[model samples]
Target: MSELRFEDVTVRYGTGRRAMKAVDGVSLTVPTGQVVGLVGESGSGKSTLARAAVGLAPIAAGRVLLDGRDVRHRPARGSGRAVQMVFQDPYACLDPRMSVGDSVAEAIPRTGTAARRAEVTRLFGLVGLDAAHISSRPSELSGGQCQRVALARALAARPQIVVADEITSALDVSVQGTVLNLVRDLQQQTRLGMLFISHNLAVVRYVSDIIAVMYLGRIVECGPAHEVLTDPQHPYTRELLAAAPHRDGYAANSAHEESGAVLDTEPPDPHHLPAGCRFHPRCPVGPLALPARTDCLSLDPAVGAVGRRHATACHFAAPLPTPSHQAT
Candidate 1:
């Protein structure tokens, strides 16, 4: 079953003349027990989608369904309790003064003393922490331990899904691996679904079964993780892949970050959105016959479904030869 589904969801900030769309017509389905990664650079609406899924962000238009229930029909806090989130910073998320056990035990409502004790202890073990360390505060633990505690709190609620927004970015590389392994172990045991949001493609590749690539405020591409990463169809995905610095691959730098690149134009104002495809302003290739962009100033290209499991939004979705300099 699908744990969550977003249909034409849109989130706008401000009002009247100043209103701007932060998420535009984004639709996605996250199946139960699957880890879906929402990846994009800052201001690309990845975090906005994460917040909307957990009821932290108000939706201006469209529907967000959680386990088949309309989240808007329920209280945001109550609905959120069913779908917990582990923020990017574990230290910031935890109560500095509260004991780790107390913080985790807080998730349960008015349960008996014995039940709460058993629950907290069980959760500690479940997250790879011992029950003896329950008395420790957030300050006493390492970054990885704090993240594990954060996961423990989320697990305490017995949630169906976990919204992990770049949870490992702050930890040391070795520590990050430990926390990630714990997450995978917990997911395997509970079959809990996850929405792993981050800009790091390597981390997403490690944890996600499916990947959804976002642009300014739209999902430009989405598919099975391996399919999307290895056989990217969208120009934006290609750009991201080329920019990612993988261990076994040649290092890459973003075209936008390079000096003297004509494609480094600033994004279009959300209020004054460009017509046709949103990515046309920075697209690097367009040989195939495609859409014309008359309404807006940017040229439009052809976009099509390459296969049943693959789709791209770029007008020139066909594969292009790799650049010579990058082939080292």
Candidate 2:
């Protein structure tokens, strides 16, 4: 088991004035045997952070560490790579011409031919795929099956950390649950440190022990799964929970009604981000609230503790009012 730590990690694209910061000074930890869910809307830099872990995205500052060693410039090689990623689109990741078993076999460290075949068979079972599909191509399998092959390929690498970037977003609604369950079961069995990225709060909550909310390339809130879900502190987080689909008996209608005005507009341009709080333009409790907090325009709030194992990056961080609170 190994832990993956991001120490003030920053990722940027392009150069000079045109450079856009995709992931800003973010510090997150994915301890062994636990899942850290990274949740945010599209373009919030959730995927960029995932890519950085596996050397797909370039890091401009800070370090990505595995077991206390910096892997920023030179990622671990072979089995030592430790971190493997499962991308959002399974079809895109797997080669169209290759057999599914061969695709998975490519990721395995060099071994005897018989051993490699046995390993592929074992991985197929591990991901709940039938051994019969070993010779199937990506086009021959359904969306859910393709994702299973993707998971199996990642497992073939024998990684200690798995970064799953919206793995289920591409599947049908009914199939998503099955894949999520497989992931949770696999994590328990292997105890692999995982960074699961998604835009859906409900999905993240179902699979994660810890959850971190991102906005405009910065982690705006982070805490234990239950605490963050039932009592979101940051306005952006609250808005996200409010907008989450009311399924699985979870509903944040009160928060939705209170903060619906915030998300009506799009987030500010990342290339030319606003000064101070990047979320100020769409923050309900900042620029849009009654009396309008002026400090949000000039002072960037750093992430700070709001509860045990809970932190939010907002000067006005507070629990979103519930129906009971409103009555009082």
Number of the top-ranking candidate, with TM-score as the measure: 2
Q: What is the Cα-based TM-score of model 1?
A: 0.83
Off by over 4 Å in 1: 75-80, 248-265, 286-309, 318-328
State the lDDT of candidate 1 residue by residue for 261-290, as single tens digits: 324667767687766667666655422112
> Which pairs of residues have clashing backbones in candidate 1?
301-315, 302-315
Position 191, candidate 2: lDDT: 93
Clashing pairs for predicted structure model 2, backbone only: none
Worst 10 residues of 2 by lDDT: 251-260
Residue by residue across 229-272, what tens digits does model 2's lDDT show?
A: 87777778877887787576555435434533666788898899
Q: Where is model 2 more than 4 Å wrong at Cα?
A: 72-80, 248-260, 303-309, 318-328
Give lDDT for model 2. 0.86
Candidate lDDT (C-alpha), each? 0.77, 0.86
Name the 10 consecutive residues with the lowest summed lDDT in model 1. 287-296
Residue 12, model 2: lDDT of 96
* Cα RMSD (angstroms) for every candidate in the order listed: 6.9, 4.9
